[model samples]
Target: MNTKWWKEAVVYEIYPISFKDSNGDGIGDLRGIISKLDYLQNLGVDVIWMCPIYQSPGQDNGYDISDHYGIKPQFGTMHDFDELLKEAHARGLKIMMDLVLNHTSDQHPWFIESKSSKSSPKRDYYIWRDSKKGLSPNNWESYFGGSVWEPDEKTGQSYLHLYSKYQPDLNWQNEEMIHELYKMIRWWLKKGVDGFRFDAIAHIVKAKGLPDADNPKHLPVVQAYQFFSNLEHVHTLLRKLNEEVLMECDIMTVGETSGLGPEQALEYVGDERHELNMVFQFEHMTLDSPSTGTSRWESRSWTLLELKKIMSRWQTTLHNKGWNANYLGNHDQPRQVSRFGNDTEYRVESAKMLATFFLTLEGTPYIYQGEEIGMTNASFQQIGDYRDIETLNFFELAKTKQMPEDKTMAAIHAKSRDNARTPMQWDASEHAGFSDAEPWIKVNDNYKDINVEAAIQDPDSIYHYYRKLLALRKQHKVIVYGEYKLMLPLDPDLYVYTRTLAEECLLVILNFSHDTIEFEWPDQLAYEARELLIGNYEEVPEERKEGMLLRPYEARVYMF
Candidate 1:
C-alpha cells in the first residue's frame, strides 16, 4: 500500500512574485508569505510548492537562476526565508521549493566561466557546438520561440538553451555538474525544506550527439520537444539522483515532464523504479492547442469528452503502479476558472464544479493561489502589460509573421503565462492590496468584484466551497485512496465518476455546461443509500434517491 503522507496531502502552489508584498516594493517577498501562513493553514493545504525564489536574472520570470544558493533581493534575504520556513512548519505546513535543475541563467558563475575559455574546467558544463558558416547545430526552436543556440562573441561556437538564451541548458553528462546539483539539494535539505518540484526535468537528457529534429520548421515546437523529452537516459540520471540525494531524506519529488504519456510517466514515478514520487504531464494542457502545428498560441474549441478521456487515462493508467500529481492550473498556465469554466455569471458555481472534479480525483491536488477566489484571466489588451518572457517572445514572432493584431492580442489574452502571474487581489484597495506601490505588472481589472475580501464575505463564494470540499476530503479516506471509475464517459455536459475503496463509495457528479439537466444514474451503477457530502448549492434536507435536476455548473459529492 502507498501509505505515504504525501499521497493524502493537498498542496497550495504559491507564485511568490504575485502572492503578497510586505515591503511595499510592488513585489511579493518572503515576508509576505510568512504573513499568509495562517491563511494557508486555515485553507487546509498540507504543502506549499513555491515557485522559483532563487537569485535570478528575471529573463524567464525567476526561472533563470543566477545563483542556486542565494535568495533574490527583491524577495528577501536568506534570513527571511528561514523565518518563513520556520513559520510554515510551526503551522504543520511543509515547504516545497521549485528547483530548476535543467538549466541556469547565463549570468551564473559556472556559465560565465564556461563561456570565458574553451579550456576552462567547467567548459563542458554547458552544451556547446561548433557552428558551420554561422548555422546552428540543429534547427530546434526554444520554448520561447527562437533558436536554442546562442553564439559566443569571442568564439564561433554556440551553446544550447532550451527555453531562453539567458537560461542555458546544463550538460547532464558532466558528473561534476551533477554532483554540484546534488550538493545544492543536500544544502537545502539540511535547511529543512520538505520537498522539491523539478522544473522541465525531462529536457535534461538531450538526444545523443545533439541531433537535429526532423523537419522542425513544419511542426509545432511541442511536437519537436518530444524528440528530446523523456529520453531513456533521463531515467538513468533520475535513478542516480534518487539513490544519491533524494533517498537520503524523506522528501517528495515531482518532475515537470512535458509531452509524456501514462506509460512514460510510470517510468518516472513507479515506486520500484526509484526515480521520483510523481510527474506532471502536459497531454491535457495541450488539448486546446491547434492540432495542425500552430503550437499553443492558436486555441481550439475542445470538448468535455476529450478532457475526461485524457484525465481518466492518466488516473487509471497510473492507478496502482505509480502516483499522480493532479493539477488543473499553475504558474505557467492561465487561471482555472477563466480557462475551463464560465468566469462571468456562473463563476462561483463553475469554479466549485471544477474544484469538485479536481480534488475528488485520485492524486494530490495542487491549488494555485487565487484559484479559491475564482480568479479569471488578466485580459491584458496591450502587449506592454505583459511581463512573461514566453509571451513577449511570441509577440515578437507574431509581428515577424505579420499575424493580425486583434488575433495576436486575443491569443495573448487567452494563453499568456502573465494571465496567471497577475497580482493577487487581496481586497479592493489600491493595487488589489498586493502592494503599496505600482506592481511589476497591472492587476486584473475585475479586482473590485473578484478580490479575496469579497469572496470571504459571501458564504457561497468559490473560496468557501473549496474550504468545505477540502474538509470533506479530510473526513473521508476513500477520497484519497479509492479507485476511480468514470461513468457516462460519453456525456457532453455532465462528468460522473465513482471512487470506491473497501466499503466507501463516493459518487461525484459535475455539470460542466451552463444548462440545467436532469441526470439519472445509469443501470451499470447500482443504487445505494447515500448521503450528500457537499455541493455548490445550499444543502437540501431531502435526499436524492434516484436522479436530480442539476443546475448550471452544479456539483455534488455523495457517500454511500
Candidate 2:
C-alpha cells in the first residue's frame, strides 16, 4: 500500500506496428514514435508500453525475437531507438518494452544451433522429447490450434510450442538459458529502459509429471489451457528475475497473465514479494464468451451484472492484497467502444463511461492508442482484408474442419486479431490520415467521424474526458493510493465504488445501462460530497438530492 511511482502511473500501450508510420513504408517505426511523444505527454500519460521491436522474422508480429541486443532493421537502427528512448524520457515519460522471454523465433541462432545435431550443446536450451508411441509427448494443444509439439525432422524429436510452430518454447529448466535471459534483461535495463511488460510470463514454467489434459467434456482447448496455465514454479522464476535484475532498478514490471485470479495474482505482485509491479487479468475480456461457443463475437448478450461482478471481484481482491492494471482494451483485443459501448448510437457517452470506470479504480490504467478518440472496429468486406497471423491460421483450420463458410466467417468476425491491429486514425483524410500510402491493415469505416483531430478540438470529446480523468488522478492522492470500497454491490444498473485515503474520499459512480437509473448515496460520505471531478453526459446535481439520477451511460467522480 506504500507509494511507488509506477503504482500511480498511467500507462499507454502503443502497438508500434499500428501507431504511426513516419517514412511511409506501410509500417510504423521508432522514428514515428519519437515524433508523437508530445502527443502522448499532452494526453497526461506517465509510461509508454511499447510492443517488441527486436530483430525478428515477424512470424508472430515481433513476439518471436531473433536478437535480444539489437533492433529490427525494419523498425530502424539502434540509434533511432536510443533517440526515441531519450526523447520519451525528456518528456517525463518512461518507456517499457515488451519482453518475450517465454519463446524465441525458430530462426534464432540458438534454435538453429540447437537443431543442428543431436549432440549439440545448445540442444538443451530448448525443450525436446522423443515421440511417445510415435505421437506427441503429451496431449497439450497450441493456442493457435493443433498439437503443442512440432516434430523436428533432423533430430527425430518433437519440440514444444505453446503458440505457433515458428515460436518455439524455451526450456527454463536449463540453467544456461535462464542466465542468458537474465543477461539480456540486464542489457536492456542498462540501456535505460524503464521496465518490461512480460509476455506470457505464466507459461514460462510448466506443471511437472506432465500428463494428457482431461478432455472428457467437449472443451478440448479449454481443458488443455487448464493443464499448463500458472504452473507451480512460475512465481519462483518471476521472483528470482525480480530480485536479481528488476528490483535493482526503479522500473515497472507487469506480467501478461491470462488464467490467474486475484488470490494467485498476489503471489506475483504483493507488497512482500519483489516480483512484478502488477498484472493484466482477462476476466473482463472473456465476458462475452457464449455458453454454447456458437456465436462468441457477434452476440451482444453480456448483462451489466456480469460486467460489474467481473471488475468488482478483481478490484476488491487487489485492494487488500496486490495491485491491478485497469484496462478495457489492448493491442490483442478489440477497441473498448466497439466491444462495450454503443458504437453506432451513444459512442461518446459510453466511451467516457468506460474511461471513468477504469481511471478511478485503485490501480494503474493503460490506454490503448486511438481509444481516447472512441475508435471502433474496422469493417472488412472479406476475410482477405485481414493481415493477422492468428486469423489466417484459424481460417485455414476452419476449412480443414469442414466448417461452413458463414460459421468460419462468424468466428473470424468475433476473435480476429485484425480488430486490434488496424492503423491509428489521425485525421479524416484518405487512409484515415494514418499514412500517405495504403496502411498495413484497413482503417475503420467510421474513421472520418472518429479521428484524433476532431476529438482534440472538442472539449466534450472522449479524448478530453480521458485527459481530465488522468489530471484528476495526478492531483488527488486518494485516487493514487487509497482503500477501495464497493458500494451498491448488488445493483445491476449502477456500478459504484469509493476510494478513501485519510480525510479525503472520492466516489465513482457509473451507470452501465442505456436507460436512466437512480441510486441512494451512501450516508457515510453523502453529507461530505463537495466537487465534481469528471462527469459523462451531465454534471452532478445540486445538494439536498434525495437520490442520484444518472442519464444514459452517465459516469461521475465526486470528491468528499
Candidate 3:
C-alpha cells in the first residue's frame, strides 16, 4: 500500500449552509469558514471537505449546480473563495470541494438548451427520450419520490433525474459533455483546490438501454441502482480524469460509492488503479436502515454484531488492496451522536465511544462540522418545519398512500436530511451565536447545552477528546498504517479491534450499550504489557489485575 498524506490525515466536512453565518444572512458562506479557520486548526484536522458552494438553484441545497465555474452569490464572490483558499493553505490545511458531475440544475444553460427542442445543439447534453406509451422511459424511481423521468412539454420528451426534478442527469455518453466537464475540473485545480469529493459518481453510467429493475421498492417505480452502479466504463472515465486532471497535480480524490460492497470498492481505489485516492462506502451507513422498504425514513433497529460485521468486513477486505474513508455520518444523514450513540442519558460518554470507533480504525476519518462538540439531531414536530425537497416530497407521497400522518411525520423527524442541516451551535446565544438573525433552518434545541463555547472551556469535553485522538494518530504510526484484526467479532455488547504494525499494536475496545459489560482478556494477548493511551473515563482505573469491567458507553485505547 502506498503511504500518502491523505492516508494519514483527518478530514473535516463542512455543510456550508449550517456551518456558520456571516453578515447575518442566515446562511453560511466562505467568509464564515475563514472566520473559523482557527477553530478547525485547533481540532487537529488536516483537510476540510466542504459541501458544494457552486452557483445553484438551491432546490437540493446546492447539489443542483447551475454554474460550475462560479460561486453562489449567497456564499460570497470569487474573491471571498480565493481568500478562504489562501487562509486555509496558510494554516497548512487543504480544501476539498464537492464535485457534482452526475447531474446539473435544470436551470443550467446546457439543460435549458437541451430542453428547448430536440434539434438544439445541446440536445444531447442531457438524457432525453420520447415517452413509452405515455409512460416514463423506464421503471426507475427518483431518490426523492415519483418517476425519475420528468416530462418536458416543449420538447415532448422526458429528462432523467435520479434525484430531484430540478436536477437533470447529464449524458456521460456525449463526448462534448465529458470534454466540458474535464475543462471545468481543470479550472478548479488550477485555482488551488487540494482535492474533490465526487458526488454520486457511481450513477454516471446507466446500463445499456436503461433496463428495468427487479422492483425492490414494490411500488410502481423500482430501485434501478443495479443497472447504474459499478458500470465498466466508469473506471475508464475516472482513469481518463486521473490522467488528464488529477495526476497533473498532487490532489486527492474520493468518490461517493453507493450500493457497493468491499469487493466492488477495490476496483475504484485499488493501489494498482489510477482512479481515486479513496472511496466512501455506504454499507455501514445503511446498517440501521430497513433492508426491504420503499423508503429509509422509517425507524429501524440495528445491533452491535451487525455494525461490527460490516465495519470489520471493510477494514479487513480493503487493508491491502485499497483505502477506506471512515465516517459515521455526513450531510445527507442524521447526526452521528444521535444515531449511533446514546444521545439521551449517556450522551457524552457514547459520543466519545463512537469517536473512538472511527478515529482508531485504519482509515482516513472525517469529522463532520459540530460533531466534535457532540451536536445532535434537530427536533422538529411537524412536516412543515422541513425545507429539504426530499422530505417534503416524501410527506406528500405518504399522504397520497393514505399512510398515517403522525407516523410519516415521526419518521421524518427521525431520519430527514434536515436533521443534519441545522445551523452550527457556536455559543449559547439566541441563534447558537451562529448569526444575530434567525437561521435559514431552526437551530437544534440542544445547542444551549452543546456548543463550541462550552466544549472549549472544559478540558475533558468531546472536543478535547477528539483532539487527543487526532494527536494520537499523528504520534503513532501503527494507527495509520497498521493491519487490522477484529477481536470479539461475535460480541453483542462490545466492539474490540487491534491494529498492528511490526512490533507495535493498539487495542481499541468500545462498550455500545447502557449497561456495564464484563470482558475477559484474551489468552493470545499479553495483559500487563499494555499501557492505557486514552479513554472516555475521567480517570484511568488503577488496577489491571483481572478481567476488564467496562462502564456504560466507556471506550479505552491501549498501546502495547
Q: Give the winner by lDDT.
A: 3
- Residues 1-560, candidate 3, lDDT per residue (tens digit)? 46899999899999998898888889888899999999999999999999999999899999999999899999999999999999999999999999999999999999988888899999999999889999888898788877899998887899999999999999999999999999999999999999999999989998889977787546678877788888989999999989887899988889998988888999998888989989999987887788976578866899999999899889999998889999998999988988999888998999999999999898899999888999888869867678999889888989898999888887887788998899999999999999888888889888889999999999999999999999999999999999999899888999999999989989898999999898777676788897889999997655455667899999999898
After superposition on all C-alphas, the RMSD of every candidate to the true structure, in Å, is: 1.6, 2.0, 1.2
- Report lDDT (Cα) of residue 539, candidate 3: 74
By lDDT rank, best first, the candidates go 3, 1, 2
Q: With candidate 2 superimposed using the best TM-score fit, by how many Å does residue 220's alpha carbon deviate from the native?
A: 8.8
Tens digits of per-residue lDDT for model 1 on 193-265?
Answer: 9999999999998888777677734643323575578899999999999998898889888999988789889
Better of 1 and 2 by TM-score: 1
lDDT of each: 0.90, 0.85, 0.90
Superposition TM-score, candidate 3 onto the true structure: 0.98
Q: Estimate each model's TM-score.
A: 0.98, 0.96, 0.98
Prediction-by-prediction clash tally: 0, 0, 0
State the lDDT of candidate 2 residue by residue for 1-560, as single tens digits.
47889988999999998888888887888998998899999999999999999999998899999998889987899999999989998999999999998899999999999999889999999888888888788888788777899999989999889989999989889999899999999989999999899999888877775678876664544346666678768878888888887878889989999976788888888888878889999988878776556323444468778887777778788776788999999888877887887777788999999999888888889999988988887657688898888788877877897988897777676667678789888889998877778887888788888888999988889899989889989999898887888788788788888888999988898888788887676877755556777788755554455666788888888899
Best by TM-score: 3
Q: For model 2, what is the error of residue 180's alpha carbon versus the real structure, in angstroms, after optimal superposition?
A: 0.7
* Candidate 3 all-Cα RMSD: 1.2
